[model samples]
Target: MALPTHFDSLYIGGSWVKPIGGETSAVINPATEEVIGKAPVGTGADADAAIAAARDAFDHGPWPKMAWRERAGVLQQLHDALMTRKEEIVQLCVAEAGSIVPVASIMQFDMAMDGLQYYIHQIERREFVTPSSVSAHTNWATGGETLGSTVKVYEPLGVSVGITAYNYPFFLNLAKLGPALASGCTFILKPAPQTPLEALILGDIASEVGLPPGVFSIVTGGADVGEKLTTDPRVDQISFTGSDKIGAMIQAQAAPTLKRVTLELGGKSAMIVCEDADLEQAAFAGLINLTNQCGQGCVLQTRQLVHNAIKGQYIEMLKAMASQVKLGNPADPDTGMGPLISAAQRERVLAFIEQGKADGNTLVCGGTIPPGMDSGFFIEPTIFDCPNNSTAIAQEEIFGPVVCVIGFDTEEEAIAIANDSQYGLSGGVFSQDPGKAYRIGMKMRTGGVLINGGGGRLNPSVPFGGYKRSGIGREYGEEGLNEYLEIKVIDFRAA
Candidate 1:
């Protein structure tokens, strides 16, 4: 991979400048294992500068006072600039995020464009908001006094810290950024250490659109920078998409400050396949969700709840499809699966594979590395049929291309086993019987459910989030924007 020296240096208060320390972090092409570019190696002081910039933008700048129509125009401009660089963004994201080249490119660019359009349409459709509650008194209408509380105004909250994970860096950035920015709140995004280039590109687009300085900033760094951003007093909200352990820690740290927090944490989502389901369709959906994206997605159907009547047949179908998943180089367009994020993650996946074997699960497909692919962080798409739900593989989030298949006797049993995990993110149920699908979907308690054939890819209009341990708050819709806003009621005194 060729390294690009001319990259987004750092977008600070209305200006792009070099890092204060003059240090940089190398971005890698996860697929080809080469240095691609460098993002600023931000420090605690840099975080302070970003926060101060956001605070000034919020408290004393025109961005906060700008009319809604003007603000909407700014967002539209940002969308247009991003769309123009759609292909470039795809290439950058694929190189940085290891998403199998063009597929990753499509997701980073085309999908984000769709989300931006969603925001534009959604904001345009809303009428002026009226207050839900009002107080009126007979004596209220004194000399030159107003009679009734006319409206409830929504105010943008202060600055927000948006920390994205590596697996879906570009998508995650837009998922949080769209709602936060559309709500009129300023934001500073901290991309994951593994993939910061996508966020950098997004920051560059913001600059290109003349997004007011202090309104949006991108400071790329590791755990230290993330900690500084989360703990800082200037930031009013913290929205993070990552592991549950880190989510808990941030929650604890942010409690003393009383900062508003939104977390889209980890999940062990399940896909239940009932006996009444069309075997072919259910199996296909199951494998696609799990194996595609190399099984790094959080809402993927990692647990396959198969009815005992069709367990054998379903396993056979799953095996055939799994074998067809071509794995070698992500740069190859035909490659079905890509490598995990890093060598440590690859080793982690390997340990879980060993654990599954020790727990007496039946290993069906892909337990070792792909042929001619031992250099990069690659793992085989693994499937395990554990007779009991108590197995380690069923209990843990492997965060790799490994899935667990558990047999169930009844609908109730399937739901029970599926809901047994700590995660309630995204899930699905496949059944030709509409009643059964609806019934099971209603009972699953996940954030999103695909009855029969719905996929994880969502439109910008749809609200996406998780429940229970899976996540907090929503992303991508009207309600999502509201999450970043503070409701304020202004009582009129003059007639």
Candidate 2:
């Protein structure tokens, strides 16, 4: 599985084309802080070209007009091609995104392919239009009353721009691509500048599979490329995965065109260890997830709320668990954790730990840099005994290998502490009492909750998104497919 050391062109209009502007940026390896490769910076002109290509394809091309089965055939081809390239994909993902081998192999590569398969399964079983009776009396106020029937049709939402994040670069884009394409929409992907090659390769695969020109395109660049994609009047929808701050800005920018937008943003999700729980199992599970992906996951439980009865024991168990996680090269299969995406990201996480110290939170374990790891952007798995839930350290997203533990007196207080964050993406409650866990899970304010050790499992059929500021709309399941579709009604009485 040899990896390419350079990407010289952007993938647009189903072809590999030179970037309009000559500018290019180097891709840095987080583990080595060295430029591993380079890719062309997508300019505004490139974005316009990609958008125009998608708009034309959606409005007047063969893809949207093809039968659902025909489109599924293309997706199946893609699925097969991706499967053949799995090892290569895994290597590139580990090199470019700083993802540990195990995490990149499954979450970044395997899950991406699984997501495509899920959409194929959905399309195979779905009906594009459903016929149903409509009561004419309900429309009597607008027109003459009569007995009527109508067909509920699901149509593609024309052109869509998928702006993806860097953390799980390929997976996030594939999540958007599988649904949007399965629903018959044309797409333009704006890959994260830091990890654009994987997406560029996706476009290559699409072309090889005979996907129609303009039906799929990838525009590579920085913020200008994103702005052009979002502000373009021709693009009908936007699917974004990144920080909440950037999500809000994208929403605001897309408002003028009234385009539909689905955002999957940041999270500071919680894990509540109830009094009746297995302290050792719960603590170990939560701690491992905190350090998984170097704490870059939006749904990882970073805030741990333990019942006071077992707080001391849980902390001891959690510290011991954190001490075992080895941070080093992402390319190493045995490395439990890897470097932050960049030196700047490491600094940001350090600042948050500094804030925790300033706020009087007790440092429990692994706050400083790891020994002998002087070159890479690395941080030891850190945990702090937060003073209360009100502190920023407990409530805000710290996108690094750091967890904050808070003690709670009652179930009511535990729930309150968990719900206090601006994010409500995913959470968990660990308890021996099934009844109590179910009751608590039902009351949790997040989009998805895991009762006991249930947070990390990957089931593509389930809807994945957040509540409140965490994000808007869902990304998987039937709900995810619906995000790229529009509903219309055809009246038989009028005919």
Assess each prediction's global lDDT (C-alpha) against the native.
0.80, 0.88
Candidate 2: lDDT over CA atoms? 0.88
lDDT (tens digit, per residue) of candidate 2 on 99-158: 999888999988888899999999989898999965656455677566778899998889
Q: In candidate 2, how many Å is residue 290 off? A: 1.7
On lDDT, the leading prediction is 2
Candidate 1 local lDDT, 283-316, one digit each (tens) = 8887877676677888788889999999999999
Clashes of each: 1, 2
Measured over all alpha carbons after superposition, the RMSD of each candidate to the real structure, in angstroms, is: 2.8, 1.9
